[model samples]
Structure formats: C-alpha cells, structure tokens
Target: MRFLLVEDNAELGDAVVAWLSMEGHAVDHALTLAEAHDWLAVAEYDLMLLDVMLPDGDGRSFLRETRTAERLPVIVLTARSQVADRVDTLDLGADDYLTKPFDFAELEARCRAVLRRRGTPAPVVIPLGSALFDPSSGTLTQDGESQRLRNRELRLLEVFARNKGQILSKSHLLDRLFSQDAEVTENAIEVYVGRLRRRLQQAGVQIETVRGVGYRMTAP
Candidate 1:
C-alpha cells in the first residue's frame, strides 16, 4: 500500500520509512505540516501516519482539513496518551491511535487492518477455487503450500482485489503502483500484470483482460 509518514524527528522518520518500505509498502516522508499538506494536495495515499506535534503546525488541524474535504484514514502517533487527546483525535476522524515509544510490529499490523477495513468486501482469507490469498502476509496458498510475493506483485494484487470487478486502466494502475515516480509506460503495467496473472493462475485464481479497457479479477 502507499503511505504518507508525517513526522518531524529525522531519525525516527527515517527508521519508520525504512521499516515500512521493507514490508512492501510505498512510503513518502514529510517532516512538517507544510510539506505534508503539499503532498496531500497532489497525491493520493492509502493511509497516513501522522505526528501530533509538527514543526510548522499541529497535525490535528491538518487531520481536520482532510476530514472536511476527503475521507483520508489517519493514525495519530504522539507522546500524549491522555484520554482527552485520544477522544479529540478520534472525533476529528483519526481511524487509529498509537502512542510514542510503541512497537513497530504493532504499528504495521494497525496499518494493514485499517487499509483492509477500507478495502473492498473480500474475505480476510480470499478464496479463489482451491487457493487462498492472505492479505496480511501477501501470500498465495494452495493445498497447504504457500509462497510470498514481491513488493510490486503484492501491490498489484492489492489494487486488483480492492477494485475486484472494475476495469482498471493501465494508466490508473501505473499511477497507484508508482506514485510520485517518473512516467510509467503502459508496457510496464502490462509486464507486471502478466507476472501477477501467472502467479494467480498457479494458485487457481482468474483475472480477466478486457479487450481495450483493462483487467479485472473474476471469481473462480
């Protein structure tokens, strides 16, 4: 998934970004509220990890603005663990809360759960004929055998599963998969789609290709 990390502490920000990236998530880091706002104005993010105290402004204000215009999912990470603080943040539309000096594993789990809750109505354990697609681990399994996916493959499958029956155009897929990157050609999308298709087929899933539109995942 694509994530925005709004944190001011340089060391902490770098560590979080690296950890999330290693877990197959595309992460963009912003050190201040201004930078976060600028990025939010142009790009789309699956989830945001925000720090309450920012250098330029309070993250709560930013969260409020996002709530007014869009339904962006945010997880407030701050040192203040007071009940009032949590209630205020949740009232302002934060989906989850994590206090400072927390475990990174817990943060990762929360991120996955938040994004999955916002996704399409696919089962937590996706069943495709005899195969099962586990979103949590990004793994495909069949007859008790399983294999993990690469970052790009996992991302491509996540998009497909989220928009199950929709015909996603190549441009749209590229935009979601390679956000803020250089222009990606349709060929690149095709190649990745081909790879994902083969993997899914091995696990007994079916992905349909529309003549001139795009691709869609159909029930087995």
Candidate 2:
C-alpha cells in the first residue's frame, strides 16, 4: 500500500522510511506540513503516518483542515503521549496513534490492521473463472491442484485483487512489490507480468493488459 510519512526530524524520518521500505511498503516522506499538503494534493495514499510536530505548523491543525474532504486513514505519531493528546487526535479523526520511539514491527502491524479495517474482508478462496486464489495461504488452485507463489507474486496478486479492474502502471506495481532500494527496471516488471500471466493462464484465470498503460485483473 502507498503511505505518506510526515516527519520533521531528518534522522528519524530517514530511519522510519528505510524501515517501512524494507517491509515492502511504498512510502513517501515529507519533512514539513507544506510538503505533506503538496503530496496529498496530487497523489493518492492508503494511509498517512503523521507526526504531530512540524516546523511551520502542527500536524493536528493540518489533520483538522483536511480530515473532512480527504477522509483518509491517519495514524498519529507524536512524542506527546498524554491522555489529552490522544483524545485530541482521536477527536480530530485519527484512526490510530503511536508514540515516539516505537517498535518498527509494531508500527508495521498497526498499519496493516488499519488498512485491513478500511478494506473489505477478503474471502478465504477468491474465485476467478476456474482458478481459486487462497488469500489465507497465498496459494493458487486449479482443478484441485495448488501452486505456491513467491512472496512477490503473492503480493502482486493481492494488490490486483484488492484493486480489481483498476489499471495499475508498471511504476506503481514496482513500488508495491519492491522497496525503493530494490533494483527494478521496466523489463523487470515485464518479466514478472509474463510469469504471473502464464501462471494465471495455466489456472484458467484472465488478467488483461491495457497496452502501453498497465494491467488489470478482472473478477469472475
């Protein structure tokens, strides 16, 4: 999923970005509220990891201003862990809250939980034509036979299923599958698409490519 991280401290921001990237999330880092607003204006993000303190303005004010229209899930990260602070952020429509010096694993888990809560509950077996994709086990089955997919393949399929019928560009797919540090080329995306297409075809599932644009996975 795409995440916007709003933080002011350079060192802390870099560390959080690196950690989230390693966890296979597409993260955009913003050091100030102005920068965060700029990103929110142009891009779509699944969640916002907001730091309450900023150089020019407080993140709480920013949340209050954009909360109505954006309606995007937000997780407030702040050093002020007082009860009042928590109450204030929650009142401002934050979906979750995390204190500073938090564990990265816990943060990742919270992000996943928030996103899951925002999305429809995935079925145990997703049926597409004669094939069934098992979300729980990340396995694809056809005619009672099952095939295990690599982590990246499973993730790609999950993204496709989650946003079924949407044309996702190659760059967006790469951002979803690999971290910023992972070396990815246009050809790399093509290679993975080829492999995924062959596997799905073997299972009698159809994934359509929008020539020169991207790909879409249709539901049965």
Model 1: per-residue lDDT, tens digit, 1-220? 7788999999998899878767767678899998898888888888999999998999999999888988778899999989999999999899999999888999988886786677724337767667777876789888789989887787788778767778888877876766454455789888888887888776556778887888888765
Q: Roughly what TM-score does model 1 have, to 2 decimal places? A: 0.78
Which number leads on TM-score?
2
Query: Clash totals for all models, in order?
Result: 0, 0
lDDT per model vs. reference: 0.82, 0.81
- Per-model TM-score on C-alpha atoms: 0.78, 0.79
lDDT of 2 by residue, 1-220 (tens): 6788999999988998888765556688898999988888877788899999899998999889878787788999999979999998999989999999899989988887887787736436777668888865778888889998765677778788777779999888887766444567877778877877888886556678889988888756
Q: Which candidate comes out best when scored by lDDT?
A: 1
Overall local distance difference test of candidate 1: 0.82
Off by over 4 Å in 2: 119-124, 129-131, 136-152, 163-186, 218-220
Candidate 1 total steric clashes = 0
